[model samples]
Target: MVYEIGDNANSALKVVDRVTETLRGDQWQPTVSVNEAREKVRIFVKQTDGLVDGLVVMVVGEADKHHGDTGNEAVFVNIVGEIDPAELGRITKKLNIDVDV
Candidate 1:
């Protein structure tokens, strides 16, 4: 579900939106916040999953740097505990994002 470096930003927004909606009302708390200066969104998701209290998934993304340059400026998402990495990977792949968890 990857998109071109110069592709649809709306799709990214939708992915975040979907993820947010899916999290609502669950014991897991998904925090969505933005950094206006960077034009990026940061997501922090955590869930107990009836196992232990910890993180679930962490993801981040932003437009690719211009002219092939590496741009550190991008969206960020972080998940901290025992979670389904496969599902998280699916979300990131679709969103064309990167994360550190």
Candidate 2:
């Protein structure tokens, strides 16, 4: 799975494709971990159609504790089988956002 912190929908989807492809294969568990700098980060994966048709990726991040706001942010992405690295690269370039891992 792809791990990223995007400010919008399009960029978040691109990050998912990029991360999923980079860690392809059964041995690679779909997981995303936000660094300690982030107050909180949670990733949830739900398999649809018996894990074949596609997957739902949900990411949630909490506001920085120092900011005095306890709100949270979230991003959701739906992915079909196989990701195109070229396409992902293009989105990454356009969005200018970094994938966590």
Candidate 3:
């Protein structure tokens, strides 16, 4: 799933914090990475009974890298494998970003 959570770097970091902490609380270990030059944050976790097991990639930078706009972001979540429907819903809720479709 892909979500737009605004383009504020601070907010993006907060989102990363919330996600990691929430997963930790659920006993799911998460590996995190941050790319300074590209302004990207990445997270990986194993799917657990109550946690998402997937890779989360957050890119924060100019929406129009070619001059469209500035400060834009897109977050992507890649589920590593199959999971229960309910678990998927729970994961989305934790991410806290609304899906338009």
TM-scores, one per candidate: 0.42, 0.36, 0.46
**Local accuracy of candidate 1 as per-residue lDDT tens digits, 1-101:** 22333344555556656766665645556544554432455455555544434433323345445646343332434445565655665765655545432
lDDT of each: 0.48, 0.45, 0.56
lDDT of 1 at 26: 58
- The list of candidate 1 runs beyond 4 A from truth reads 1-5, 35-38, 47-101
Tens digits of per-residue lDDT, candidate 3, 4-95, equal 55555677667767776776786555454555654555555566566554544444443556765545665667667655545644664576
Ranking by lDDT: 3, 1, 2
Clashes of 3: 2
Q: Which tens-of-lDDT digit does each residue in 10-57 have in candidate 2?
A: 455455456556545433445444445442222333344445333334
lDDT score of residue 17 within candidate 3: 71
Among all windows of 10 consecutive residues in model 1, the one with the lowest summed lDDT is 52-61
Off by over 4 Å in 2: 1-32, 37-57, 65-70, 90-97
Evaluated with lDDT, which candidate comes out highest?
3
